[model samples]
Target chain A: MMIKLETKSLREAYGLCLVELGKRNKNVVVLEADLGKSTRTVLFKEAFPDRFFEMGIAEQNMASTAAGFALAGKIPFYNSFAVFASGRAFDQIRNSICIPKLKVRICGSSCGLSDFGDGKTHQSVEDVAILRAIPNMTILSPADAVETVMMMEAMLDVDGPVYIRINRNDLPIVTPENEPYKIGKIWELRKGKDIAVFATGYMVKKALEAAEELSREGIEVRVLNVSTIKPLDTKAVISHSKGVKGIVTVEEHSVIGGLGSAIAEALRKEAHPPIEFIGIQDKFGTSAKNYEELLEAYGLTSKAIADAVRGMAGR
Target chain B: MEAEKVKELKKVALKLRSNVLEMVGVGKAGHLGGSSSLAEITAVLYFHKMRLNPKDPKDPKRDRFLLSKGHAVLIQYAALVELGYFPREELKKVKTLEGLLQGHPDMKTPGIEAVTGSLGQGLSIANGMALALRLEKNPARVYVIMGDGELSEGQLWEAAMASANFKVDNLVGIVDYNRIQATGPIKEVFDTGDIPAKWKSFGWHVIEIDGHDIPQIAKALDEAETVKGKPTVIIAHTVKGKGFSFAENSAAYHNAALTEELYKQAQEELRKQGELL
Candidate 1:
């Protein structure tokens, strides 16, 4: 199944979505912690200056304030870099937002290794891990611009707390522009019987590419895009894993407590074949000159994913 | 405030203390010292200061109250039951499985504004409510009661700075300055020296008051409404475990399961205090 690949950055998609939300809902407000320009929340700020809040580098304050706004009958979209949003304000998000199940949207921009040149401090490989530990938090990791926009559209109707992670650079559009978005539902892009590559975020596109490359060698890779990391589409993951010779999980995050770990946990009781995880090993990342170099250095490339799948498939 | 009103408020405060004691006994493991410290301030707000209707807890025009130091939620639970937010029977089932109340302030419990248990989070929430109220053009105000030791949490200072920067004049933060925390004195655990000056420097209208003094608590709240262009922080110098002699200023009672004998002693203390009031 071929889909037209449009080129649009996730950050740009986020900015446009905010403007769309601004026009549609008066109760929607956006808050940022002094990185609005980099995070692309400046678009929302310009359109809804009255509703936009510049929290000035205070991520923790932004989180609780968003919680407060939720209490006062307003849906708040609080934005920050992934590390700051998830790591710095974990307590606030956990206590104020998750515990109460407030209607707040926390978007962590430049997640994973997307902020490639900035080194490990800005990269948030553990954002999902930390947030997953908190109860009542729905984690949504959009694969591309289309999914990001759709996720933003879906956030308005989400009654509980949500964290939507976005990438910094342009990721090839994998999901169709007209594809209906559903939280915790897997999007199966390719059909195969030999192996299933469960991937998330930017790695979804990589998985698709790896599957395409593996088609030459007749590996018959089944690609599953695990968008909503938490409230994970476990049924989809398990059902697709049935009868497959092997399963390979790919992500731009730590293999310790990420999508790989979540899938492994879900499949623990069920009888399944061996699985291989292709992500950053348990090690700190250094400042990379480019994202491509970072991906290659971390073994987070299509070749590496294909290599893992080949090993899983015994070929 | 009139003398009769002050006397009546003190009587209500004593009743609230009794209610806290009863609730804590039911919950088995609850913050006795911290909850007792805020009884008078909580009583003053619910009975005399904040405009609230128990029947309409979600009233748009009603004032909002948030217990920032949420571990000390037993007293707030007491006041809520008295105000008819929930039936009195619910109070007896606190801390039990499937109970209406939990150890901390949860929105699941009626009349709770924000669910706060982790420290340094309530002020930012109050600031959010203040901004929302101002945006909606509602005349309602927000009241947040925090613990003294909770001030050491960096997020509170962030909220304090943001509140001042945003001019959240409709928000009033009352620090239950009981000095004593779970381990020991706040000065010993993590000293935030010069509490009033810290709040003042954060651009809040700082007011020092005897938090246990019902009339003075009422007066500080009244003064909060008159302040313009900034939020107000009432550094309420309260005694930890006020009205309960054995528990007063004792960190052991901060979050203790009262023995049957201690519970009886607490009831007697409240009984004697009620007579004095």
Candidate 2:
């Protein structure tokens, strides 16, 4: 499949989705924790001021309020940093949202290495891992701007609690705007027999790039963009890894309980292979010059992934 | 709604209290003191105040109740069982795996509005529910019960501020001021001075009452309904344990398994009051 080019930044994509969400449903309420502009919910707030709320810096209260809105028959989309959404307000999310199975969407913007130099405080490399432990939660990480729009639209249909992790930086548009948005379905971008690369969020494009690089070196690398982390496409993973040399899971989160852990769990009791996890190794991140350097330092680059794949393939 | 009904409600409250004691005494792991303290208030809400339908637990028009201090779930569970939300026999299964009644209230169980164990969160969730009801133009009121010790959480103040800002008159909060937390007195753990005055200052309609008095609890609920354009807070002064002289005002009974001798003694006392089943 060819990568489609749709020019839209992450912020702009979020703004567009907010606008669409605002127009499509009156019950749709947007909440921000002092980052309405950063999370790109300002446009929706301007249009639907009555529906949008600025809950100050209290992410915990913001989560509780969103759960409240859901109980009141409204679709509340709460925007906050991934760390605060998953760490600071975790109890609120688990209790108010997940326990009742309220239709609350916690949109965690500025996730993983997206914080760049803001360092460990802003970077949420372990959020996905933590949230996955909670029952009745739908975890999702879209690849790019188009994927973000698709996921935002798709979230309206998902009942119970939905958690979406996003980043601050722009990513290459890897999927076409017209791509069918079927959440929980993995899209196999490239097929090969050497190694199956499972990647999510901003790292999907990198995995595809690594696949291309490995293919030129006489290695058939299958690249899969695992969009929906929860309700994981286990069948896709199994078929994609059929007779493959090994499995390499890549993500922008901690390697502990992120995408790699999910894939490893699925492959553990089955036809398993040499598994390599590409993520932050159980440590806090730092303030870097840019997201690119942060990604490279965290071993999230295409070259790093390619090298890992080469090693797994015994090259 | 009548004198006879009030008498029946009081009887129900006593029965609820007895059921609470039996469950906690059997489980040997529950906030018995707090549960006993809030029994009458729970009865008043379930039996007289709130328009809840056990037959239609999911009735969208039904009132909502959130138990913020969920450690005292035996109180809420006892009331729920008596109200026919679940089998009255299920009360005996408290804290057991087969029982829907977990250590805390769960929404998965019938009549439980939300999952609560962590304190200082119920009021905010209540505020949100009230705000949502107001936004949807729903007439159903949202009620929440909080422990006096739960006021120590800073998030409670945030909820207080948000409730006033939203002007959620449909929300009613009741604080069971039993004057005891887990270890000891609430004053030692945290000082949230002047509970009623604090809520009043936050723009809420404040009512204080003897929580064990059914008529007083009823009057306070009636007064809260009249306070327009703002939410209401009822401060019920209650003993840690009531009806049982041995456990009354005793923090050690906060959670204690009643031995066979103690259970028999408590049962005899409850039977004399015509409360024991």
Candidate 3:
């Protein structure tokens, strides 16, 4: 029998969390680049009209302005589409925010292929890769609404600049609600000895599903949720990789510089099992009728992940 | 302004030039042209305008200044050194690995509001600070200096619109209109026509003045603080390499090593200017 799971919108959670954070901290301000409604920062605008800045389709200005706000002892969160946030305003984010080590939180909403209808122009597959190269940047990718709220809170305590990727859809509520979130600690959702699966963002749900599928086939698959991409928990990754027959790294980002590469770099110095990367194989996303169709077309489904594990497990 | 104050500020300007020469040293390329162009403006801001305490450089209520045209940072370093933000001895170690002063403005150095070597970014940061200060009901103001050639950056225009849209009256922007850039003349390279008109059309309170004139610089800054709803931009027309006769209006000196002979000549010129003041 197939068990049903509940889903929650990460954007909604983000909006509600911002309102709560605003009420608690008067210094918390929000800046948006004419995508408030889409990014859900509009909710913050309605609640704290005085603190919200309408930067008007200018991501570069918004990013640098957010740096200014940080310099003045305010915690500024600037939001834009992932492509523009990480690509168009890259120089501002690098020179103004990261280089100075400001207390600014950059929210790249609708990251990955979650914006399936918009196609390659709007989707951001290389944001992680591009941001990872910058110094003094903390990268976060939450799996579900619960994790999004947790990550948002955790971002407040971080001393330096942070980049958090948010998906466009309501994903499966996989992360536990009561558990406290740590910035760089890896979350192991399942215990197994046969195969290890490291996943992040919405792909964490897929990895859990793949684990269940592999379990029925008598393959014990371990699923690890890697929410923090930069300052990666390499110790946990190395410790978990030991004794497992093989490993499968999954993300909704480019396979080149995403979680797979991070895990590969972590285990390079240590003796570990062989690894398989399950992500977009160096391809831009195309328009699809729905999100699931794009995920399936790109071989990002549970079945494909299970197949990778099975192939690596030699079953 | 009193004659005594004017003479004092001109002397400060001359000292800033001398310090720039010291930092660049002989036979080592540095941003002598832009840095010299900003000598008078930096002298006025550091000595007359801008509330700063060297002991408490990060004072929350203190006025903020950012060099958007950060290549001209040698002048700012001179001002900071005079203000005792750091030891004057650090001037000799600029651009060195262990030096406190860098080739551009960095937060690692004292009293720098933001990292702003890359052009077109400092104005937006100033706007952000203005908005925050207004939100907090703080009376502190923000000032940013931009190069005329630096205005070619698209982000600068974006920030221009934002500052006016937000009505950042507490923020002031001064363009070091030296009319020269790294490669050549801004007019020949990439002319941004009608500079004053462009700023006025952007809804700023525009003021044009001789940047080297200390009294005019002080008056424009005073006028900016009284403007109620819009930000102000002072277009301070200046000569590139103002103090050094050999480098004046010459792009070659924009960032070039000063030979020992030329460096001595530059110092002698600044000393003469100081005597006249």
Q: Pick the candidate with the highest lDDT.
A: 3
lDDT of 3 by residue, A236-279 (tens): 99999999999999999999998999999999999988899999
- The iRMS of the candidates, in order, is 0.6, 1.3, 0.4
Residue B213 in candidate 3 has what lDDT? 93
**Local lDDT at A109 for model 1:** 94
The DockQ scores of all candidates, in the order shown, are: 0.85, 0.64, 0.93
Docking tier of model 1: it is high
- TM-score of each candidate structure, all chains considered together: 0.96, 0.93, 0.98
Model 1 segments more than 4 A misplaced:
A1-7, B259-261
* Model 1 per-residue lDDT at A279: 85
- In model 1, pairs of residues that clash are A33-A57
Native contacts recovered, each model = 0.84, 0.67, 0.87
Better of 1 and 2 by DockQ: 1
Worst 10 residues of 2 chain A by lDDT: A1-10
Query: Cα-based RMSD of the predictions, in order?
Result: 2.4, 2.8, 2.5
